[model samples]
Target: MKTLSFDGQRPCILQTASSVGKKEGEGNLTPFYDNIFQDAYLGEKSWEKAESKLLKTNLKTLLEKANESPENIDIVFGGDLLNQCISSNYGLLDFHIPFLGLYGACSTFVEGMILAAMAVHGNYAQKAIALTSSHFCSSERQFRFPLEYGGQRTPTSQWTVTGSGAALIAKGGEIEITHATIGRIIDYGISDINNMGAAMAPAAIETIRRHFQDRNLPNDYFDLVVTGDLGSVGKQITQQQLKNYGLDLEDRYIDCGDKIFDKEKQDAHAGGSGCGCCASVFSGWLYYLLRTGKCRRILLTATGALMSPTSSFQGESIPGIAHCISIERKTDNQ
Candidate 1:
């Protein structure tokens, strides 16, 4: 949590995005469209529609299960890919809560969670809502070119997913954070976007080790250690490299990117990056464990390739940053 000033209250995730796969933050946007690629969100849609869908799906779930109306929430904390976070505009259409937009590129999920948690942990407020979503088409058109066009993608490129994910965190509620060790964003500016696995692993390794140091948390203290979306290559590098540092994340520390899609069938080179990659996976898989009591203490670290097409085109390298936050189930909630 970056507190340049005062933080009112740390927030807890009240909802887990939409709690559905191919659905996460996506509502009615899933059906077939004119183009298969377009159906996969090849181009940007209207902000009005995009934001509305995010709010409708995520907010609907929150209202249904939390036993609260949109009016009761203290604040709505979120942001999207647009300049002013355009998707958030429509998300605010129906909800009457105060809104705040945040941007950390693909790291937005952890960023929101970190901010929300800090605000709550610091005794700022009782509850706050944090959420983030990404559209494959909207991001592509805005950041690069339309996905429908046959644009040459560098090997390091990661496909953005057409999805949205939201989480609600409440303090003195059901779930509680016994300890939180925050990681500073570390970057290695490597130019080749085709090989993000190499660029990002170092940061994840360094940050996780720091997490162990900050909290004196042994490698086995957690049931599972999860990385945001470093695909297979990065995950391998992390698993192999961490051993050299006397830190063993092992199989228990898994990568969310590799689990999201069938890499062999999806042909996702090194798997997906972007916001939706982690968002959808966390909503679909992690939420399941939270509800079913499969595993309680989870350390999830999401990474972002902090480079744009413009940066790559300008002969700059890809810089990677990872944010580590520990989220555990609230035994008391039930």
Candidate 2:
């Protein structure tokens, strides 16, 4: 039986690339992304197509950065917020690599990374690409009202990001994926569609706490700790929960959603929330920070709300999950 946390050989992170839309391009991590499309559609006919293009562009950039061809990738793990993860499925169709489609809502990127790392650690693959994406229009159309509806949004509502992030996992690299803590589903019976942050908070707290206990490590073990798409609400709640457990993250916690937009000026009510939320940040800004030696060891706990449009309409409460992965610099890996 698989335990809550597992230990294995570290897998290398050979290359990474982030490609984002115009809005994210203007955000704080603008300087970190490899490519930023001036047009959100990227010359595609529809918002969905735009999202597919974002993933395709992200993969192209990753391959270029690694100086490798499509055949070089042993396997591809990817996902998105779409109904069937059509964005990732269709985006890489031409590549013809063995693909494993996944869905963890906002946690898709980290989930993919965890699986990719596992494959490498087990010697199943020499190279794998872990990637994910999200688009505001695409997600909104599928999960909420139409984009043209102009419906008033609640303050708890979060803006879905429009972008993609990809990373090449291979043997012998400067960055190593060291550990993973798979989360169990937790539902606090939250039914509101707008308050995903609050709904996902408990799961994030549980996963972080479990990770600490499983590793027998203190809060200071990692130089940085981040969560996926939790925004302000989840971050605060998770922090309070951690305080109760005597695990104070203090200055180490970074909620990827909270850093994605200017809440006040940008009208992003609860900041960014989507699969791309952490993906773009990690592959772009956070990874850059790690490479620059600004931090040594980092724990990324990617949170996801497992409620679908059908589930929400059926009056089912949102169930949340969080998967954590430890990434470290070459020196720290030693």
Candidate 3:
């Protein structure tokens, strides 16, 4: 899937438990992970119920801020943590737009957005919204033990947050795609779930180097070059590795995982995880930065950990890949 790359519409901001603040500030919140799934332990309640609440809250916030209605939306491409995308399915039951369900692990946000933009650009749809979310409790219950269960996080681990993020992508609007460079999926099959940071770094560095090389774009072309979420370790490896390719991101490159939180002592080893780690923070701070002329151009490179039960059983290295896209502000006169 591809599209004419463009700047985002007015962005949306919704939080679950991220401890955002100053650089010297505390960091992302980690309290929710501790006792989140205890409610499930007590009852047979469906996962969609509580999650729908978070999704709806964020959706409503985005819709109201964008002055949009469900009927005005051409389609909603979404995904989340649950069997058959339960959160996305139940979350959009009320929106009434045609839905395209997607999954890219933590990279779901870009996958959805890219498809949605292509649909509108190709005249397949007039307008579409791409959204993705991840709740720490829901993920841990299925993937690992609850945090209150007192599991130790190795330095490579990431704390998933409980948040839903929505973006209202519009077509024939003030903003439009200006340039787009698609990336090939590069998987080394180095699958290690526990040590995700190192597993994901190679794919990220590969995609970033290729994207810049393919588009003939330099690191200074954009105000920031952002990655989906590689936690602290992956980010370091990516930066160092990118430099080897003669691409120095300098301080201009940042990680959504690290940026989502403003604090440091929250015990979140590296940073946040899940789809929301990138979607929500991008919709919030990045959007704010672009719309206000603070950031004129942005390069968002979302990475994925393509792991499966079968793959894990096969003891395959965590298959890692990354996709890259470039977005910038729309000039009034240009």
Error of 2 at 329 (Å): 1.3
What are the models' TM-scores? 0.82, 0.97, 0.84
What clash count goes with each model? 22, 0, 16
Candidate 1 regions exceeding 4 Å error are 1-14, 19-52, 151-156, 330-334
Q: Which RMSD values do the candidates have, in order?
A: 5.2, 1.5, 5.2
lDDT head-to-head 2 vs 3, winner: 2
The lDDT for every candidate, in the order shown, is: 0.64, 0.88, 0.66
Cα error, residue 287 of model 2, in Å, equals 0.5
- By the lDDT metric, which is better: model 1 or model 2? 2
> Which of the two candidates, 1 or 2, achieves a greater TM-score against the reference?
2
Candidate 3 lDDT over 171-246, as tens digits, reads: 5443444554444555665566776767778888877777677667766887898998888888999999988888
Order of models, best lDDT first: 2, 3, 1
Candidate 2 all-Cα RMSD: 1.5
Against the true structure, candidate 2 reaches a TM-score of 0.97
lDDT per residue as tens, model 1, 1-334: 3212212332345566442234222322222111112233222266335544644566566666677777766666677666567777776767777777877677777777777776766766466776776665567677777657986775455666555566677755444444454555566666676677677887778777777776676778777888877877889888888878888877787887666655555645666666766766676567667566787777777777777777878988777777777666666323
The worst-scoring run of ten residues by lDDT in candidate 3 lies at: 12-21
